[model samples]
Structures are given as structure tokens and as C-alpha cells.
Target: MIDVAELRIGTSGWRYPPWRGDFYPRGLVQRRELEYLSSRMNSAEINGSFYSLQRPERYRAWVEQTPDDFVFAVKGGRFITHLKQLRDVETPLANFFASGVLALGRKLGPILWQLPPRLAFDAERVEAFFKLLPRTSHAAAELAKRHDDKLKAEPHTDPSPRRKLRHAVEVRHPSFAEPESLDLFRKHGIALVVADTAGKFPYIDEMTSEEFAYVRLHGDEELYVSGYSDKALEKWARKIKGWGRDTYVYFDNDVKVEAPKNAIALAELLA
Candidate 1:
């Protein structure tokens, strides 16, 4: 039998200066920002890891700062997605997993791999990358053992073997909107990210995974700037309610400090 789908709503990232005195209360220290955000939202997407590998200590500190039930969706490193372009990334993937990502433990959620706009859909290349992904924590740990000397000094190689992992791909190029791309993702149980980039990226709403659905709302009218209106939130609420699979919605419109407010607004509608 299928389990009841869960809805996790929050922002793409939490550390925003503009949020000070706006979404965040005045005098709230920068370090305590995550602690405050967790009090209201159930999940958040960690985008820093997308830029570079994060140490295990940082991931552990994040877990301690948040509530027990909080979950974090980590963005895969750009070194793997953008630089390598999903080619010959076995060791890069291992290094990423070893670089303390597993420290999040049970609070760890899906791994998001956002493809660059310049990278078009390549079926063979995409399939090969998917094959390299570890299906469970145990497999991830084993893969982590293969990390290069770069992470040998301080790596989080071991993790709980009980939990399974999920991955989702966010595509930008229009080439990914075809049926072939959707079928490829379905064959591998990878969620095709429904990215709302305000006409900046190709938006594909198809659910490729039976396990879950991932959505990123960058903005409604302007990419990373505009806030979602009540009307837009209502429309999204309806769409999410209709998705039978578990859903994760993260607001990425942080430029104008609208992400948190919009996330709360969308969560309220879903509630």
C-alpha cells in the first residue's frame, strides 16, 4: 500500500542579510538564524554545498541547531554538475559524500543536482551519472571510502546504514522538456524538479518518481526577486494537493527577502 504523502515547505536557503529585522526579528545573531528558521519551517535546502564541499562539523552543527524533525535538502556541488557536467564524476561524487554530508543523518533529505542552462540533455551521460549514485547510506559510505586525498584529512566516511537516499535533478535547458528526458528519469526513479524560474528556465511538472516530488519556486513574476501573491500560493497549494507523492517545496526568491514569507504563506495554504 502507498503511504500518505508528506509536504515539506521552506526556503532554498536561510542565511540572508535582508531577512534581518524583516522575516527575522531584530538583534537575532547571524549564527542563530537557522535556529529561528527551524522554529517555523520543517525543512530547508542547503545551497552552500553547491558551491563547495562542506565539512562534517558544519553539517553536525546544523543538525544541533534545528529541531529533531527538521530535514535539509542539500544541493550537489557545482564541481559535479557544472564543472564536470556529469561526466567522469565517480570520484567527485565520492568526495562529496565523504565531505560530511552524511553528518546530517536522519535529517538529511534529497540531493538536488541542478543542471546549468548551457548543458543540454544528453541521455547516455545522464544515465551513467544516475548509475553512480548510491542507493542507501551504506552504499554511500562505501562510495565515500573511495574519496581522494583532498578529503582524506577530514572526511565523514561513515553514516547510518538504515536510511535510504533520494535524488532529484533540476534541468534548465529546453532540451529536457521532451518525453525522452522524462522517461529516462522515470527509468531511474529520479524526480524531475519542477523549477519555477520566472521564464528563466524550462519548467517541467511531470512526476518521474513515485517516491516524491520536488518543487522550487524561484519567483512568480521575477526570478529570485518577486514574492508569491495569495493567488499564486493558492494555485500552488492546489497543484501540490493533487500530487499523490510526497512533496518538497522550497522558495528560492531570496533577493528581496521574499522567500521565507512566501514559504510560510505557501505552507499555510497547504496546511
Candidate 2:
């Protein structure tokens, strides 16, 4: 039998107000929402980290909120992907690591680096950024040591090393559909994100990394609005099973509070 233990099903972000009276229990306190979500899902994407560097205490709190088996996939900062465009971002990357991501400890899963829709595929630029990615927590800490003054105030640079870190690149531009992009990601041992974005972006499904596969389900008929039907969920489950590697899937169709529902339903199918 193919081992499904490597599969993790979850939602991109969990703090939606629409989910309050519906998915999340009506009386459940706001602080315990994560605790509630963790009880149902095995994983979640820490998307707030993408907007800005998070504090160490926040990551530590997240560790406490979730179950021991639950994993959190941290999103790479937009400052590195969008603003910096992955150029000369050594310090920015270091600062990101230093800002408390390591505090997640054993619960930390893959790091997702999503490129903007406007950023086309540039082999040299992409490869250069991939070279800077640390494959392990220890290496991340070593890189963290190079962080600038921005993180000097109580930066969580050192935490005992935990599991091997994995990276997944989510490219939006159509230029990334080429085989060369896959080859570059494969060369760096980075998983190419299989994104379902309702035709707004390139939806690539090739498994570039043998280590694992990362998938993001934005929506079905509408971007971040529509929900996946039963057939869609079943198809995804079968595809994940056939991947033959650890796979992480996060539902991003949260505008209608369908992400968690879809994630839970998909997990049942896989189960």
C-alpha cells in the first residue's frame, strides 16, 4: 500500500472572520481558533509571515497552539519575492530567518516562496536565489547570523536544529511553464508548487522534486471564491497518492470560508 502518512491537508490561513460562526465554533474564543483548527487539520500555511517578519513570541505561541503532529508551512516574505524580486536579498533572507521563524521548531514544515504574477522566469536570477536557500535549520541559523540591525533587537537567531527544511517555489508567470524552470527547481531540490488559481496563473503539475510536492488550491471556478466539488476532491486525492512523495496541500479558497471545509473533505478522501 502507498503510505499516505506523508500527506498533509490544510488551509492557507485560518484567521478568517467568516469562519467564526461556521467552521469555527460560535462560542470559541478568538485566541483558541488555531487550537480548534489544528484539531481538524494536520497542517496550515503561515501566510502572515509573507506580509512582514513575525516576532519570535508569535511563532512560539503558534507552536503551543497546535498539536504535536501538526505542521506549519511558513510563507517567504514578499519583501524578498515581490519588492526585492529575489535579487541581492541575502540580508533580507537572513533577517527573515532571524525574525523568529525557527521558533516553530519541530512543527515547521516547508517554506513557500511565491513569485508575483508580473515576475517572469529568469533562470540566472531564480537560480541565484535558490542557492541562498538553506536546506536545514542549522544552516538557516548560520545565515541568520548575518542579519542586519533590523533584527538585532531580540532576534531569535539560534534555536536547536530540528528537521531538514524544504522549499517550494510558486511561480505565477506563464514563462515558468517551460521545462527549464522545472529543471532549475529540480537541480536545487526545490519543489515546484502546483497551483490551482482558476486560470489567473499558470497551473503546473509536474513533480520536480523527489523529496516532496507542494500544492495550493486557490479556487475552482472563481479565484479565492468558488469551492471544489466532490469530484475535484477525489481527483486531487488520487493525484496526491500517485505522487509517490511527501505532499503538502493547502486550500486558499477562503473568501467564502470553503478552504477549511474543502481541506477537511479532501483529508477524509485521502484517509
Candidate 3:
């Protein structure tokens, strides 16, 4: 585990009701959850963006609430991946960029795009979507300027003051396992997500980018409801150590309030 690159461990989302008493202190207000969790964990994924667009104020508040070292991985909207199937999504992509995501500022980590199970591998379509993504924060903010009226108020199209705009794609279909998909990632410098879905989805741990790696742990023994056992955590710690690259690991198994506990445990193991 020595000489390995920086490792970040955290949960997918912080606003789960089930975690109130276990992960979060009892009687803690909902608004303070991120503040409390960020003190213990180093990073997390903003799951809300996957469902709908969020305002810049929220992103600013998130950045203000967390510590300086805390980073957030923003989930790309499903409109681009599922509904539109990555076709003619230029506006949607622009809207996403304009939707105050850059407000995360230096706290922003990577943007994650998770595809549905039904969508199979289409190199042309995938490549098009990948090419549309902006590599640097300045480029993303520049693209955000083309956002439509959906944003309503002033958008956070400011240039990124921190790292480059990194993107990670997670495909559930088996077809993406093909080698060609890997090529597309290399060409675009996109990281292939290493998702552990308890066999419910496709698993691709391949590192297509040298910049960083992303891993989503949906569950171990069960989907969403189960927690990682000691042996399971050890296995993952060893594997993560072998990566030797900046890695962000997010636990998606929050159904039973295990995501936070498991994430903290894994973080300790890596530490």
C-alpha cells in the first residue's frame, strides 16, 4: 500500500434518512449532514444531480459547508445518458455545465456518467459524447455560457479555479467490456469507472486514464442493502493500493445506513 497515489473514500450521497441515527447523529438537522460528514470523510458524490439540475447557490453552499480539503464528485444528469441516449444532447450538456456545477470550485473532483443497463456499446455515439465533454474547467465554463433559458437566474459559468474538468463513465451493459470502448476512453482521457455492483451490473476496473480512477461500490453481498464485510474491505484496500493512481471510491450501499460506516472503515484501512 506504500507509494500508492492519493486515495479518497466517501459515500455516494449524504442525505439519506436511514442514516440519521447511525451515520449521522440523532436529531441532527438535514442541512448540516454534509458539514458533519465532510469533517470525517474526505470526499463524496453529489447524487442529486443525477435526477435533476441543481442551482448554483446549492453548489456554493456545499463548498462553504465542507472543509478546505473536502472534494465532491458530481454525478452527470441521466438526461444525457439514459433519456437522450447521448444523441443530440448538446443543449442538455450545456445546461448541465451551466447548472452551477462549477460553483463547486476547487472542491470539484470528477463528473460521473452512469449508463443504464439497456444501452449497449456504440463506439460512435460514445465517442461523440466523450468529445463533447470539456477537459479543463475553463472549457467547461465556456461551454456553459451556451446554456438555454432553463437556468432562469444567473448561472455559475465561472472558470474552474482548481483542477481540470475530469469525467468518468460507468456502463452497465456487457457490450462495453469490448476493447474498443477502452480505446475511446484513452483517446478522450476519460476514466473507466470500476463499479462493484454485486453482479447486478457490468464491472470494468480497467484504468484508461492516468489522471485518476473512480470506483462505485453499490453493494457486496446484497444490492444497496448490504455492507462490506471485513474481508471484503481488506480485499478492496489491497486492490486500491495496487492502482498507484489518484483514486476516488464511493460507497452506494446506503439502504441500511452502511455506506458511511463502510466508507469510513475503508478510509481508515487505506490510511
Candidate 4:
């Protein structure tokens, strides 16, 4: 069995400006934000990687700054999920794999692939994408080797292959609520994101993987602005404990700068 200690609770990102006054100290410098934030949470979702590729030095610096046990759940780029729509994305996938993510090595947790609201469930397309995913860092390195010329220069091409690579898929379409979707996820060893999107997206609470689980708490009442109430945190704690699986929960309700506070509250409840 996989180590259950991999379970973690954290917020999506730490670079939000609003969090400086509320979660971060008033006089803290911007450069030291990650270090301070890591001390408070065992894990954090790297949302910036979703928008663009990250450099090796950045990953190395993050590793040096955070505690030895800290892990980052890197978000997959939208170029594959949003723009390319997961089709004909071999090169894009290669670019992502080559984008210094492996530098996180053991500090890396799950890679989150969030599909847009417009993309509905298609078993063929989904299966194709899943097959392309690398099951291990070694595999990712092999995939990265095929990266186009754009990333050839100064690419962090080394493979760590520390442990098995895990992935979680977050879908917004209502069509994904079906049993077939769950079956597909289970077949590919991918976790279905248990998301709370203020009733805006389809909320599916099934455990597709016994090895691990992934959850994104967008908000309790409002999508990105509202905080999870104490009662809500307590309920989530109970459910999470009941799962008895290595779980990763990231609070995405950061518009009001309540994500870190709510995430800490939930972690405390579990404690």
C-alpha cells in the first residue's frame, strides 16, 4: 500500500496579493512569501504552472525554501486542456513534462488537469489523453525528450523517477457525472476531483482511486469568494478521515483571501 502520510491540506496558490494583509504578515517581503506560506501548509497547488511553463531554478528555489516534507500539486497547463482540447497534444504534453516539474521530484504530489466547462465527456478522447499520460517520472522524461525546439534550450530534462506519478482530472461539464466517467478514471488510475463549485459545476463525490484522492474546494456558497464555514470544515474533516486514503485537498476560494485560513481550519479539525 502507498504511504498514507502523503495526505495533505492546502490552498491552490500563495501569490495572491489580497492574502498579504490577511494570511501573510504585513511586513513580509514578496520574495519570502513561499517560505512563509509553506510553514503554514503541508502542501500547495502550483496554479501558475497552469498558465505558463516554470523554470528549473524556480523549482529548485521552491524546494530549498520549503520544509523537507512539503509537497506541491502542480496544475497542468491550459494549453492542453483549454486551447488544444486534449487532442493532438503530444508536443504540448512534452513541453509540459519538460517544463522543470520533475525538479520538484519527491516534493511533487499530484498533477491536476482541469477541463473547461465547455468540454463534455467523450470516452474515446478521454482514453486517448489518459494513455498519453506518463505513469512515472522516467516515462515523463521519455515523453519530454520529444519536446519541440522551443523547449530544447536549457530544458530540465533529467528524470528523477522517485515514485509513481499520479494525476487527477477536474471536469466542469455535467456529462461527466455519469458512471462511465467514473469507470474511465478508475481504469486509468486517475482520481476524479471532488470539487465544490458553488453549484456552478457538477459536483461528484466518488473515490475513483483507493490509492489516493484529490479535491478542490472552490467555495461553499460562492464560487471563488466565499469561505468554508466552521461547520463546513468539520463536515469535510469527517469525510476526509473516513476515506482512509492519501488525500490532497486544495482550497480555491481565494478571491476573499480566505483560502489559507479555511484550509488551516480544516487541517486543524482533522488534527
Best by lDDT: 2
lDDT of model 4, residue 35: 95
Better of 1 and 4 by lDDT: 1
lDDT of model 1 at position 137:
90
- The C-alpha RMSD of each candidate to the native structure, in angstroms, is 1.8, 1.2, 1.1, 1.9
lDDT score, candidate 4, position 206? 91
Q: Kindly report which residue stretches of model 1 are placed more than 4 angstroms away from their true locations once superposed.
A: 1-3
Q: For each candidate, give its TM-score against the true structure.
A: 0.97, 0.97, 0.97, 0.97
Candidate 2: worst-modelled 10 consecutive residues by lDDT = 152-161
Question: What is the C-alpha lDDT profile of model 1 across 1-271, one tens digit per residue?
Answer: 1233677999998999999999999999999999999999999999999998888999999999999999999999999999999999999999999999898999999999999999998999999999999989989998998999776348887778469999999999999988898899999999999999999887788999999999999999999999999999999988887787799999999999999998988887777
1-271 in candidate 2: lDDT tens per residue?
3484488889998999999999998899999999999999899999999999889999999999998999999999999999999999999999999999998888889999999999999999999999999988999999998998886357886757556899999999998989898889889999999999999888898988888999999999899999999999999888988988899999999999999999999988887
lDDT winner between candidates 1 and 2 = 2
* Model 2 alpha-carbon drift over 4 Å, by segment: 1-5
After TM-score superposition, what is the CA distance of residue 245 in candidate 1 from its true location, in Å?
1.3
Clashing pairs in 3: none
lDDT digits (tens) for residues 1-271 of candidate 3: 3455567899999998888888889999999999999989999999999999999998999999999989999999999899999999889989998998999888889999999999999999999998899988888988899999887468788884845788999989999888898888888999999999999887787999987889999999788889999999999999888888899999999999989999999988887
Please list the C-alpha lDDT of all candidates, in the order they appear.
Answer: 0.92, 0.92, 0.90, 0.90
- lDDT for 50 in candidate 1 is 95
Off by over 4 Å in 3: 160-162
Model 3 scores worst on lDDT over the 10 consecutive residues at 1-10
Stretch of 10 with least lDDT, candidate 1: 1-10
